[model samples]
Target: MEFVAKEKGFIAHFSYGDLHVSGDDEHGFRPFQLLVSSIAVCSGGVLRKILEKMRMPCSDMKVTAEVERNEEKANRVEKIHLHFVITGEQLDPEKVKKAVELARKNCPMAQSVEGSIVLTESFELVS
Candidate 1:
């Protein structure tokens, strides 16, 4: 697997395999962005299936990540928080919580960052 990045002003063009991405950040999907994105995508995929199995059909799901860096480190993310907003009809809070727990345990991304970064999660439900 090879990845390449080219800089063009504030945006950087990135290509890897069949994936193409452009980002305003200097390094494109910087380490932190890639890390958080992994977490978001992994959890999202698992929860979608879990929700379906629980008979709670989700209409939409969005995952947002907020990372705080340590001043001393200058460029390292010290802590990260993820928010999962789920929209569906008659969603069960218990099932949602359980799904999140299961995802955290099974998601590869979450497992990958286990010892490196601090991760926290919060859930929101919208009717």
Candidate 2:
């Protein structure tokens, strides 16, 4: 991906659209926010797939990511916690828990940050 400097930050061009990235929130999406988003979304997607493959498809899924940064270490990312809200009927919590573990292991983004950032997951089911 190529990024071009803008007045406020930089814009990266992709087939879908342009992504604005910067340190300042007003300028664009902060780098840390993007990082956390990528990990959360990747894991969520993988989890969804696993659920379907395991015959536990959900009607809807929403993922929220919470990030922890270390101030003493130049504000680097220390951990990311992902919470998933799944809406469906008769969804077994045990099976969902298994899927979560599988997702964390299969997700490329999660695996990429394995040694560096701590990744955790939780979920709640709605009928």
Candidate 3:
């Protein structure tokens, strides 16, 4: 597997194992970070959409990922913990939980990574 990224303007070419990334800024982490970001973003997006559709009116949503690395395998993230903090007004807890469950079911990224990766979810509601 190979990935290639050509410079559009500011960043240089980047190649990785089936994933490519480039940054205009110097502080970019790596391609693995991009994968984590993608998962987090996808989960958040699905949850937000589901909540909104349920009339929950999500005022704020945050997904924080804590990745556990393999000690003997050169620091590769083997498992991930996804902590979600959802803020809204007049929200039903049961509906919120259902939305999260639906989001996990419908999230493409989560489905793609489910077999090979361990993903844990915890939620908090802000009144």
The candidate scoring highest on TM-score is 2
What residue runs in model 1 are displaced by over 4 Å at the alpha carbon?
4-27
Ten contiguous residues minimizing lDDT sum, candidate 2: 33-42
- By TM-score, the candidates rank as 2, 1, 3
The candidate that achieves the highest lDDT relative to the unseen native structure: 2
Q: Model 1, poorest ten-residue lDDT window?
A: 8-17
Worst 10 contiguous positions by lDDT, candidate 3: 8-17
Regions of candidate 3 where Cα sits further than 4 Å from its true position: 1-27
Q: What TM-score does prediction 3 earn? A: 0.76
lDDT of 3 by residue, 1-127 (tens): 3444455322334463233354433434465676788888999999999988998887888899998878798767678888899988988888888988888899999898887778878899997
**Per-residue CA lDDT of candidate 1, range 7-27, in tens?**
532333346324334444643
**Native-structure RMSD, model 2:** 0.8
Angstrom error at residue 66, model 1: 0.9
Number of the candidate with higher TM-score, 1 or 2: 2
Measured by TM-score, how close is model 2 to the native structure?
A: 0.96
Candidate 2, residue 71: lDDT: 97
Q: In candidate 2, what are the lDDT values of residues 55-74, reduced to their tens digit?
A: 98899999998889999999
lDDT of each: 0.78, 0.94, 0.78
- Deviation (Å) of 127 in candidate 3: 2.3
